[model samples]
Target chain A: MILETKNLSIGYSAKNKSKILQSSLNLKLKSGNLVSLVGPNGVGKSTLLKTLCKLIRPIEGEICIKGESLESAESNALAMVLTQGIYAHGFTVFDVVSLGRYPYTNWIGKMTAHDVQIIENAMASVHIGHLAHQSAMQLSDGEKQRMMIAKALAQETPLIILDEPTSHLDLVNKIEIIHLLHQLSRQHSKAILMVTHELDLAIQNSDEMWIMSQEGIQMGCPEDLILDGRLQRLFQSNQIVFNQDQLHFQRNHLLSKPIWMKSNSDGLAEKLSFQLLQKLGYYLEAGYKDCQLELLSNQTWQITKNNSVFQFENLAGVQDFLRNN
Target chain B: MTIRILLLSILFVVLSLLSLLTGSVWISPSEIYEALTNPQLNVVNHFIFTQLRLSKTIAAIVVGMGLPISGLMMQTLYRNPLAGPFVLGISSGASLGVALFVFAGSSLLALSPWLLSLGLGFFAILGAFLVMLLVLTVSISIRNSASLLVVGIMVGSLSTALVSVMQYYSSPQLLQRFVVWTFGSLGGIHWNEIIVMTLVVSFSIVFSFGLMKSMNALMINEDYAKGLGIKVNYLKIKMIVLSSLMAGIITAYAGPIAFIGVAIPHLARNFIHTSDHRKTLPIVLLLGSNMMLICDLISQLPGGTTVLPINSVTALFGAPIVIWIVIKNRSFLNS
Candidate 1:
């Protein structure tokens, strides 16, 4: 392993006995593999990444890069080989990525021809070569995210760590980012670790995944996780049931009755109903009873003649009031 | 590199001549240069150039170059454009130290001039160092630049208040000397004082160069600097120490020249657009030295031989340049 943490306990040591941000978190990254860390909110994913990067001093464990203790390893030497790109503010796309060459730079901080070439190559790697000279403040959120990744690539570090890299990205941007990480792992041989919410993409792309749970962190392959039933346990939400074959969650039962308008249009109301459900994570399926829509969690729709009734396991009685009346 | 150094040295020489020739004495340029070169042949001319003109000329160049470089270091370390030795209470600290020394009267002044200067330099450096350290600590603890600024200004006002108390206790004879010192005279600094100024400024500049890379990283972000193996806390302390030392020594000799530190580096920035200090610092020294020499010369106004305070002269020239730059920066940011 190029980078590994041994029985690591992560968090601030400000007060006594407060070292349990995430405990028993042992992780290892080989020289050139992509790994993603996925967990629910407040599960210490960021804390784990920061711990591995040595940004915050971890409590009650050792982190080693290339068999050397992280703390004892020389910062300058570690800087050249193991680096993370962090966003400060308002640096140009070029200006920011150029900072990756700082370790090789002289006291004057002048970039040589070789350094400039590397920054260019890094920008090209992320397909942000056109925005090289543009200010980062001008770029769209997706573009800026890519620019940040370009900066990490420019560092040319063997081990790269990212925290919630695709938190606010759209679906397309999310896929592109995962692809970019995949490219770096395969083509560039960078040991990539990213914290993400996209479990499906991570499970497919990663060689290993570390499941950070309230009980403890467990490491295994995607297939191993599925075989062991940890995958189902990981995303344990009552609203939907996961299909192992298709890798999607489906509504467990019927919601309100499906509204039939000549049985011709389901697209428009389906979109509107889905959007309304998103507001409170509850939605009405189309059912028949004076064109009524009701809220449900394990939502499904049973279509009737013209009216609709939504179904819920427990809240179905109260939420189905409109149809009942 | 040798050529650049030589050019600056020559520029210093030319300014010295202009400083002597441009005054109310109105010595012709030829007579000025000839008299300046062959001083032994002309006793009266020697007194004018050596005792009066040369002393002031050297003091202006030294403090001008010294103060701004100190200011540049402060700005780089603190990562604030408004930061400088004087504006942020570093110079006021030195002024407070001087006020104490001047209030103590002739007995303290009777100590070896270097001892008195060192006495003044130490406390001034201590005062400035304390303020810089406080600003650094507050800035780090809060991680906010604007609040540190308000704190710095309050610190300066507090130092001013301390000096005022000292001024109240001083005798009229000592008071006059103190007031004269406060006016910031390049005119009274002797050859020995100039030597001290040169030695202190050169040494501080050399020491500050060692911190160039750290300062560059700091310019990007504090976290970036820390990540790059620079101990951010240690780098800040050393910058504060070096800046205070240079400001303290110059203040000891030249009595707190105003605006040189605050204004010249802005001009240097306009000249050298790069945020890199290796390029920025040398240019700051050159422009600062030039501005002080010109200010010293322009200070010879037509007031029936009533000379204006050099601080007032510097404030007059320096304030507008700084104001213009600030205004220009506002527009630059907006557009």
Candidate 2:
């Protein structure tokens, strides 16, 4: 095991009082695995990550890394990437990556040839070696996020923890970052834990999911948690719910009756029409009902309701007709 | 980078020579050489060179190097580009000390001039140390750098307000003396006071080099620095103490010299395009030294007798450079 928390309690403490965020959590992380910490906003996910990284003190219990108590373990043994914004004013990408060698360097932070090789390898692994000499401030948000991950990788610790590493990234960048993290965990044998709100991506990519809810934390394989219906406890809102079949969250929209939709093939338009109907609180099915939709050629939509046929040249017209009628 | 350093060092040497030569009575290089070789033979030239010009030049160099280093440390500590050596009101605290000394120690003015200045230095350091303690105490509970900067501004304002109240009731003579002190002077420092400033400023600058690695990590952010195993709070306190010591000591001797502290670091960063303290430290030191010498030489008005106050000269010379850098590299401050 790379990290194990026994009866760990995390929270904030003032001079005279302490506010407990979460308590009585037993969590274990092994090398060569990617764990996603999923929770609602304000669920103390960041506080838990902070406590685990020792940025803040744990309110109770022991956190051990590699069989040594966290309180006593040297900081070089662990590495973390925080969600805090960092602006690399004048530092190059290579200079920024070289900062990860802090724990290993001497008092003056002079890097040796071995350390340089590690930084090079880290940037190459993240596919950012081409931008080594580029100013960090000029990089795109996705590139900067990768550079931050490469920093953690260069730390050479057995475990790495990231807080929302994929936030503020575009769809392609998000997928690429998650995929890179998965590869790093498996190929490098580094136990990786990340806190993220991308539930669908987490479900598809993570080896284990640590679900933080109001009750407590539930840790298990994503499939196991889904099988036991533990993911439903994440939110109390009736408008949003976990969809077991799709392995993602869905809106609990009210439906009057099922609407049958027909298409020669499910192309972008059909998928979009189906999504629009579902979003408008209409249940979609294969069989016919009082309301029916057929995609004609030339990107037109035909809707028949109550034996009345209506045609829309665009999906917007279909949306307007459905929303009003 | 090496070439830049070499160029800056060469500029520093040239500026040092110019500062030494440009005085009321122009002493030729031959006379300067003669005065150095045989002090007893050329008493007047030797006196002007070693006793007057040399001490003042050393004063300018040390203060120049000290203030920028202090400012660089504070900027990194508070993560603010506008932060300076006196941002925590060390200069104001020194002013308060000097004000109190002038009003309360009027009787001591009858004694030797050396003793009076010594007493003033004592009180100034004491006041700065008191404020340092208060800031550190407040910092223990305040977690963020922005809050600490707010606290520092408050402390500075409090000290300035107190100094104002004292200034309001003082006699004209005492007021003039205090006001003149506020205008700041590099030439007023004699050998003994220059020795103290050199020791304090050089020691602080040297000691700061030891903090370069931790400071580099801190440039990323506090949490990141802590994750690197840096004792963040301890490092902050050390930076605070070191900067306060340099700013306080220089203020006590030179009377709140301005602009160099806040401007030189920016100049160095713009010139080199890096914030790594290990590299910037030397560049800032040399750049600061060069800047102060240039300011001092300009204040003397080269070839004229009357001298402008160092404070006004720094503001006049430095404000434009800072404005240009800010406009040219708009994002360098935050970067």
Candidate 3:
């Protein structure tokens, strides 16, 4: 366990009484564990990360990293730490990443060739090497996010904390970032604690998911979350329904799919076929991509794809159409 | 190119030479050289060359270099394109200090020129220090750069008004002396004061040079500076101290020689078109020194005859160039 938040009441006040989230948060985030702190908006996820980084003074909490308390650490003498996507000043990608060594830097802030090599390596790790000379503000959204990751990597922190790491990314960008975090966790032996609202993706990609709910913080595997029927409740609203068995959201306006055409393709084909079905008003399977065309609900799509041939859901319907034609 | 720096240095040297040779007492170049080397010709020509010209010439250089570097610091600190040592009430503080002592503090202008002028320098520095301290306090307290700049200008106006009141109370003899100081003469600045000004300006220049990278970053925003782990407060405090000290001392010696401090940095920024402090600092120093020397030389060209105040000439020549820069870079200013 690189990090342990002991009774961490995190907020920004010198006095012990003005804590925003007062709870005994005890968790050991170790290497090879990708943890997502998923909660609704404005639930002190950012505050917790800020507190952990000592950017915000926690009112009544002691964040013990490795073995020492955060307050005991000297000016910027924290055991390796990085805050993701934080902008404190304008610097070149090279300049910003070089600051990860702020604690190690001398009075003159000299960067040796060895330091330059480390900076280069970090930039390459996050794939921002080409942007070395570019000003930070000029970067695209995805590039900026990657640069932040590079900065964190440059810090080489054992425990990395990110607040809303994927806040402004599209789906592809979100997945790529998650994939990068996963790689860093595994390869670098970094304990990654990311705060995000991305439920399905975070739960899927992370080795463990940390849930911040009305019930309190809980940590469990994705499977346990599904089986325990706890993951579905986080985003359940009056207009939407959650399928505990399937571990996904179902909107109220799904339509049924035709059967005979859903019997031909394999797994990848099933997804593409399901997408094609969705475009063509055909329904997809709830949990398994199994080709089962059944009357589940009126105006709701009980979709079917590829059949007994490949055992695909949406693909089976397309197969059925080929045979009929 | 580094060669351009060489060229500029050479040019500064040549100008310094021309300034030495072209004065009213036109001894031959050979005679000047002989006076520099030989003991027979040394005392008479050396007195004319060293005491009368070299000190004033060097004082002009110091004044030139000091104002712009101080201006550069002011510009970066306030994040204001127009902010400079003079515009920020520092010169007014110095002017007020000089006015108070020379005019109101005494009645004998002819008898005691040097001794009473001691208080002039001290009061000037104090005024400049007060203005800077007020600006620094307001900037930190308000947490807004623009408001701080406005407050500095307001303070300048207030100080100027107070100096006027001092002038109103002064005797005729004291008023003539005070009025002469207000005209901003580089003449009669003691060799020692120029040496002290040079040392103080060098300290400021070095102080600014040390914060080059981070100050470059500061041109963006404070938050961005923090991300790079730059302790912004320490940097700001250090910079304000250096700039105020430079402005205060220069004001003490040169009687609020205006526009060079305000204009030189803008010209440097224009020359580079980059926020790089490394490139800008040297240019500000060189160009500022050059501009000040030229302004002082032109004002003392025997045609102005009455020895026009360096402050007024600097305004006449410097105002348009700086205004042009501000208008051209208006977009940058609004940010």
Q: Which candidate wins on DockQ?
A: 2
Model 1 lDDT tens row, A1-325:
7787898888777766575777776777886787777788887888777666667888888999888898986553232212233332334678767767777787667788998999999989889999886766568777767876776777677777777677677989988988888888889877888787787788778877888888778788777887798877887877666767567545554344333222222565455455433433333444435444432223443323244343433434333543444
RMSD of 2: 3.0
Q: What is the TM-score of chain A alone in each candidate?
A: 0.75, 0.92, 0.74
Task: Report the lDDT tens digits of candidate 3 across residue range A158-255.
Answer: 77777677878899898988888898888888888888777778867998887776556778887787677777667677655664555666654455
- What is the per-residue lDDT of model 3 for residues B130-235, given as tens digits with 9 covering 90 to 100? 7777876776677444566678778889988987887787677777866766667777777767777788888778777888777765665564455456778898
Q: Give model 3's DockQ, 2 decimals.
A: 0.13
- Model 1 preserves the real interface contacts to a fraction of 0.31
Interface RMSD to the true structure, each candidate: 4.6, 1.0, 5.4
State each model's CA lDDT, in order.
0.72, 0.86, 0.70
| Model 2, total clashes | 1
lDDT of 1 at A206: 82
Off by over 4 Å in 1: A15-19, A40-42, A76-93, A135-144, A167-175, A197-205, A222-325, B1-17, B104-106, B302-304, B321-335
The Cα error of candidate 3 at residue A283, in Å, is 12
Q: What is the per-residue lDDT of model 2 for residues B165-282, given as tens digits with 9 covering 90 to 100? A: 9989988888888888888999868788888789888899889999998987887778888888899989987888888788887888899887788899988988898888889999
Location of the lowest summed lDDT over 10 successive residues in candidate 2 chain A: A263-272
Ranking by DockQ: 2, 1, 3
Show how many residue pairs clash in every candidate, following the order shown.
18, 1, 33
